[model samples]
Target: MRWSHAALNCGDLDTTEKFYTTWFGARRVNEFDLGDLRIVFLRLGDAYLELFGQARPPAGETPGGDGHPVAGTVRHIAFQTDDLDGFLRRIEGQAEITLGPLDFSAHIHGWRSVWLRDPDGVIVEVSEGYRDRA
Candidate 1:
């Protein structure tokens, strides 16, 4: 099966939505509001993004603390780009580059990647010359 969307919990839905739409070119496809909760779906190329937010904690579970990036999970959600240099220029002074613009040519010929941290603390990888294999 092909990969789909990555869902994230947003403390502020509007900010999260704007971050993706502005920086990564994701567009809103659908949205829902259930009183204390909100969900927005966005599409980027063939992939989708699902964002959910809650006004308060549920009955038993505690709130996620400190707004820090979680580690040892998922690693990252990657996007392939045709122009890694041009993409880097576009995000300059606007988004935070957490890592890379480094070479991965050791693994794949002509491959390079850069990682950015989204507003919701998700690591997004933008790469060139990488593709799914059969």
Candidate 2:
């Protein structure tokens, strides 16, 4: 089986949508009003990333995080592509990379990743790995 879509709760749905659309190429496929707020569905490749304005925070306390796994947590969702550098150039205005295109050749032969954030402070990882795709 293959992985499907994921959701990220945003404080401002329009802002988050604009950021992802501009930087990551997400396309809007559906949207619905929920009386007090709204929900938007975006398509990114074969996956869907849903945005909910009135989404409740996860149970229990979250440190300084924006209070959701998708909002802020090292458990970030990643995307893999062959043209890592080109993709980085396209994301120029959206975020600043914090980590690497650092070589992992010593540990793993075909793994390189760059980390950055979305508008809601959600970390996103873009990686390139030849072996895995092979």
Candidate 3:
């Protein structure tokens, strides 16, 4: 079987929705209101992404919010780009540029790649030459 969907917790539902739509062409497919918070589900092609508010602790207990980096948990999500230069320029203002569109001659079969951090500090990769595999 194929992988179905994945999710990321977003602090701002609106901003998360807009980011996905603008950067990855994801369309909103569902929404849920939890009184204190909301969740938005977005889809792009066969992949799905869900954004939910951070969970709160029980009234009398402390929040179990971990103090580690989210990027360390799942590595990253990558996107294939036809125009790596233009894509980098477009996201320059929106996200934090972590790495370059440097040529990865060995690891990526001579493709160019760059890494960016999303609003929640999750790693996102933009790479060329992925289309060659298709």
Best TM-score among the predictions, by candidate number: 1
Q: Write the per-residue lDDT of candidate 1 for residues 22-130, one digit (tens) a residue.
A: 8778999999988878999999988999999853422442212222254655667778889999999988987678777888788888899888877666677888988
Q: Name the runs in model 3 displaced over 4 angstroms.
A: 54-72, 107-110, 131-134
Which ranges of candidate 1 are over 4 A from the true structure?
55-72, 132-134
What is the C-alpha RMSD, rounded to one decimal, of candidate 2? 4.4
Which candidate do you rate higher for TM-score, 1 or 3?
A: 1
User: Tens digits of per-residue lDDT for model 2 on 27-115?
Assistant: 99999997997989989888988888865544665323222455545567677778788988888765766567676766667777887
Minimum summed lDDT over a 10-residue window in model 1 is located at: 58-67
Backbone clash tally (model 3): 0
lDDT of each: 0.78, 0.74, 0.72
Measured over all alpha carbons after superposition, the RMSD of each candidate to the real structure, in angstroms, is 5.2, 4.4, 6.0
Poorest lDDT segment (10 consecutive residues) of candidate 3: 61-70
Clashing pairs in 2: none
Candidate 3 on 1-134: residue-level lDDT in tens?
98667788776667767887998788998889888878878888888888887643224422112212435466677778788888877877887777676787665575888877766665778788653443
